[model samples]
Target: MRAITFVPGKQGTLGITDVPEPEPGAGDLLVQGLALGICGTDRELISGEYGWPREDPMILGHESLGRVLQVPEGSAYSPGDLVVGVVRRPDPEPCGACARGEFDMCRNGEYTERGIKERDGYGSERWTVEAAYAVKLDPGLGTLGVLVEPASVVAKAWEHIERIGSRAWFEPRTVLVTGAGPIGLLAALLAHQRGLEVHVLDRAADGLKPALVADLGATYHAASDLKAVGFKPDIILECTGAGPLVFDAMLNTAAAGIVCLAGVSSGGRLLSADAGQINRDIVLENDVVFGTVNANLRHYRAAADALSQADAAWLERLITRRLPLDRAPEAFDRGQDVKVVIELGE
Candidate 1:
């Protein structure tokens, strides 16, 4: 099968090449790739920063939407079903935390997280995986629901925000989302659905225009001047992964407000979030700070539900560009791309 892969044996180089198709293991589902997304992590994996197997051929794509080509006869999902799966392929332990229905804490695990390890990924003509990892989308949901995985990531933050928040669903309050990256825009969209007065901040106004068109969130701003304007919010989610800005949001959140840190750094640089600063600025201020990672299965369901409820107009905004696998590199080049989908075998 043809794929764009990172072929570094150790501390090494990046390139695209052909590779063998995957063999779905026990409880596995074989899926044909329909569309895949290029994520920042993929870029880092290319540079060998995200810890790709130092001595193996690494397949790097984790975001995708597709259809089941085959599965065991009684696999609980039908072949030809539309699906979207997560980035993580966790280890299995039936008697452990996940089997007790606690998937997030599952221990004895193997991450067949393709494009990052020995496992082949979805950025190819075909992919095979554990049927348990597959998530079937309702036929009623369509293409946008096909995007449920990433969107659910945003929804998870909202679920957490709503949980920690004192504001009732009936009461309207503002939320300030910093950064207009895909994650940030998605956060804004979720906040909009919750009926919060939403403010989106982004330096590239054009970059945020699509989000504006969806009316996913109202008001865009230069990334600069966020602090000077006093756009205090009951909740703020820092999706840019800029630690300094995270601290800014922490300081600015209204009393009893919540903040979610949703981004991952690429350059491998560290920032200081002083303990005294946390005690004096956030804790003393009675703010909630949550460092959230990937969502569990429930967030996936909620994200699907939200996608199902959303209008067609919104999905169109999210799918900014659809490129063939060969053109995938351009998707990562900086400037003028919100979310780029690689249409596999198109």
Candidate 2:
């Protein structure tokens, strides 16, 4: 078997090498990946900025689709079943936030990221996972199965948006997605399906060109003058890691509007913001800003179903490129598309 392994050493030295194949035992499973998606976190992990607490050689793929080659009996999973699942788990002495099912805030961070901490990752010829932790994907769904994990994050955030605005969530209002990247585009796609007029704001033209060509039912704008457009978004989903976008999005939201933070920054550098701006200009100004992270399996279900009604007209136009696993590093470095899927074993 072959897998991408990261050892304790200088970053970028992680490599694919032959490894022992895994077999299902106890409550575990063996999966054969069809397609896996890479996110910005992979870069952070390779660079050791994501704080994975891992020093030994470890496998590195997370967002992936695989068939259950073997599974413990009586588990929801079965051999030959397709599935998608997260690597995070609840810590026994987890913080209040995580005890309530928020795995991101678990006090014991090591217990929070399973694939990175304890288990092997998906970027391998064979992968093993706790059968109870996986979500069974209907094989009939095809490649869309690989999208469940990422799209689920958007679905969870949407649940938050609906709660904040109630009936006004989609009433002829504008919405802005700060980055226009894959996550940003997923949010745009979701917002568009809910009948809200969506627009994307980005500083770069590299990825937006394909989005425009796809007619994703979205309008694109430069981030510099969002207010000049004279339409304040009722809700903003900030996918840009830059802090200025959050400040600007708060400033440009309508009364009772909400801003959800979807980007992750690992440097621990705080973004400067006006103490009074969020209080006076946002809260006092009636704008709400919140942060979001990974999703549990429920969101995965919604994301898979979203593909059915989401402008199927845009599918081919939306897939920028599909590259083999060996080229995953180059794709991350170049960031050449809206959504890049890593082709795994056929």
Candidate 3:
């Protein structure tokens, strides 16, 4: 089997290599990779800025959609079924959250994340996952199901937002999503599905992103334009990790607004901010800012359901480029790509 392998903490070590096939244990399902979505985290790993992988030479993909090649007897999935393997797994010494099936909220810092942390990911020709962690997708979803993993991240964020918003008379009508990447765009999709007025702010106004935002029947604005005539959003999904934008989202939201920080920042860019005013705004407005990352089985199921209801054409447009396994390196190039997928052979 050919897989994309990298030595974590070693910059410029990513490449395509041949590896042995995955052997499934009892209650496991063997899946052949169909498509793997590349994101910022993969770029970070390639640049040696992210956390070290559990395995020295690690495969690098978390957003994966595949076809089951073999399944254990009595498993929910069957051979030839479309499925996605859940990424995060509980630690050996499980925390209270992990024991209760909330591994995404694991109290301990020892959880293993496939492709990101202590496990080999789904960036290979074939992989094995326990049946419990394999999520079956609607066949109609096809390759678009690769978006499910990132969608799951936003699903969990929305779940937490509603939980926090319920403290007051929460009838949110407007939403502002910062950044127009897959995560931000998907967040906007979920908000649109909920009948909220969606506004997306991105740097690019002429690329596939702005066009996609327009196709959603939502408003799109550049950051400069948004700053000039701002709308206080009821919910702010901060999908850009740029420090200034994160601060702006916290400072410029509606009263009783909920802001979810879904993007991870790279440090060292300093911006002067008025600490007192930021604190005052939060205290007086009863605002909430929370950060969410990774997803559990529940979110995966919710993401699958959301994809099932989404416009298939819109979902297809999110994938800006597709490359064969050999051209995987080109997929990491950050040149105007919305979502890049490496299509593996069956």
Better of 1 and 2 by TM-score: 2
Q: lDDT per residue, candidate 1, 1-346, as tens digits?
A: 7776665444345555778877777787888888788777776677655654655566657776778888887788788888776656455434366555545445665433556555656677687766666677877775565477678788878877777764443243888888776788778877888877888776664644544634764666665536744667877888887767766777777767788888764456687767686678776767778877666667877887777777767666777788887787776675576777778753
Which number leads on lDDT?
Answer: 3
Q: Order the candidates by TM-score, highest first — what do you get?
A: 3, 2, 1
lDDT for predicted candidate 3 compared with the true structure:
0.91
Cα-based RMSD of candidate 2:
2.9
Best by TM-score: 3
Ranking by lDDT: 3, 2, 1
Each candidate's lDDT (Cα)? 0.70, 0.73, 0.91
For every model in order, what is the number of clashing pairs?
A: 8, 0, 0
Report the poorest 10 consecutive residues by lDDT, candidate 1: 7-16
Candidate 3 clash pair list: none
Predicted candidate 3 versus true structure: per-residue lDDT over 8-46, tens digit per residue: 888888999998889999999999999999999989888
Clashing pairs in 1: 27-131, 28-130, 28-131, 29-129, 59-115, 60-115, 91-109, 91-110
* All candidates: TM-score: 0.86, 0.87, 0.97
Q: How good is model 3 by TM-score? A: 0.97
